[model samples]
Target: MDFGFGPEDEELRGRARAWLTEHLAGPYADIRGLGGPGSEHEAVAPRRAWERELGRGGWIGQGWEAEGYGNRRLSLTGQVVWAEEYAALRAPARVGHIGENLLAPTLIAYGSPEQRDRFLPAIARGEELWCQGYSEPGAGSDLAGVRTAAVREPRGGAAGLLRVTGQKIWTSLAREADWCFVLARTEAGSRRHRGLSFLLVRMDQPGRVEVRPIRQMSGTSEFNEVFFDGAVAEEVVGGEGNGWTVAMGLLALERGVSTLVQQIGFAAELERVLASYAASHTAPGAEDAVLRDRLVQQWAQLRTMRWNALRTLGASPDPGAPSVAKLLWGGWHRRLGELAVAVRGAAASAGPADWAPGTPYENGLDEAQRLFLFTRADTIYGGSDEIQRNIIAERVLGLPKESR
Candidate 1:
């Protein structure tokens, strides 16, 4: 398949690059590489400000084709070009991605007209941020086993309200999110994927919703534990008791243009590691032939992953494509982290002696050290390696299901 861009795509790439360069200054200058995975705790106010900046540029929902949401409809290739440029410039990690890339598309596909009007404009304006409340303490990978319940209030003016009650673990941006898209069991005694509903709940319900940050080994709280105690959900996407379909569709959408954007970031990280290796003459194994070979292999594999992502872009639905993409990038990033620490050798273990309480992890350690510690959970967080393999085996290869 031809991976080369057309003239129009090239023009888009140039425009995107210029826009990012021109606007990523002043207050947004320091946040260029902030708010990414594990380092999400950095520059919160500025990153939120940067989201509005992106909104003003009409760069928030480039892929959405909806009319009058303040979003410019771009072709898939154009979206890819924008993403590539964004990552290339190391722009602030998007605070609106969950809404833009996931919920917006899902809304366009399955959401009600009222739902779109109510939420999409705020998302497009970067005024509202969203968190996914799908993963529970017990249903992280086995999402079908979620026990969160959303009972509809049957009395008076509260009749349309769904009282969501349960806990969601590993919810990214939970604290910053203005809303959460929750998957709950709306039917009593429902088993597995049955009786599920995709409900949107506001996060500002004072006494009903609580968000507690979960500090990781890397000393960051990007992930949070969100508790909903009779939280009210007024909107249900794709109808009630159809969350299993909507949730699965959203998961599939995860493997779209964002995969290429992620690869661009991965490539940037790899380049940084290579630069570290080149300069670390005193570090042990920096001169090792094996280490050198591994670096070369990392470059080659990253190129291969990019090709695979481009080839699969906008292709027919494949059951295993998202899983495959997840497995590839997840393992690649974890390995890159290991390589980063390995290249630094003894220096990687030593951090600042005066590390204070409540300080960001990056303050005490170098990028390599932080990268190594943070990537440890890469394969685990976004569906484990084991889960990806099972998806491929059962869905794509037609293998027998693993005995539960």
Candidate 2:
């Protein structure tokens, strides 16, 4: 576990730092990798342009084969470096990222030749967008209980003409998405987990979909609820009847590397908080000291999450490890938010410092408050904190599974 970089990596980091310093400027607080302007708009042109910049420069795709898609044979260390630098830069999460995070790996693992050829290049190019559709009314934490039926059309014109019909909730960033990777109940009459199937729907089609936003406590439509009608055929990533595995794989990725960015970014934010607190020179008070201690504890938790991700990504593919990271960050985020609110005092509930006009400190404080409230769902999504503990108990700690 040598954190030290080699000669080449040092050179790469230097180059990346220079490029970021030159390119990123102004008050663009939320700019992720190659995505869209916002979740409300279909930023096809803007996203594609950014993707082209990354693709042509060989800066986007990592750990993928060359020519077939984007970049080639990106080292694990390289991936870590990219995440670290990007987090350090404080870039917002990327757009068109659902595909980049979940489907890309599935494509590499089990997608058809045509599927790979058709989707990979554009995904790498960010010409298109993707969203996940796994959670259902009956299956949020218990994803294996998904009931979204994707029956094959009798007179199928396409290879997999699945007539998807069910409801999915908490579909973040889905309102303007062009495509979605939906997990449905393909094996009808079959038991849970065994009957599930993953289907890719072209959301651009009419009479097939409906996406509505779930206004969060933060008053933003970051989370959404999507409905699917039995209509056009859909594509399958990996293979049919393999949706259970594919969905789980995607969940692991979602809660793991895709989420690794948040942990590191939180750590960076903690550092910023530390610097800010030190420079403020507030009067000594018991409440202030308690709040300060809480933030310090939060800093420790963020470090734990980073190390956990590093070990998981670099070592054994423990199915439960991502759950641990999710749980840690969820709780850590809430704790820090509470502390941030405490520091902001009356204004904490307004906004982040210098982020917006008026009392942005209060805004940031409010933002943290909203985040802390949402953290309640952290363990539940991508499986639950209870489930994560079960995993670690049985798998990592070698405890016997419960005889239910």
Rate residue 131 of model 2 by lDDT.
Answer: 86
My TM-score estimates for the predictions, one after another, are 0.95, 0.84
Instruction: Name model 1 segments beyond 4 Å from true.
Output: 156-158, 282-286, 355-362
Which tens-of-lDDT digit does each residue in 36-138 have in candidate 1?
8878888888899888888888988887768889998888778778888888888989888899999999999999899899989999889999999999989
How many Å off is the CA of 198 in candidate 1? 0.5
Compared to the true structure, candidate 1 yields what TM-score?
A: 0.95
lDDT of 1: 0.89
RMSD of 1: 2.1
Q: For residue 274, what is the lDDT in candidate 2?
A: 67
lDDT of 2 by residue, 5-71 (tens): 7877777777777766655544332344323211333333444454455555556567554355765
TM-score of structure candidate 2 = 0.84
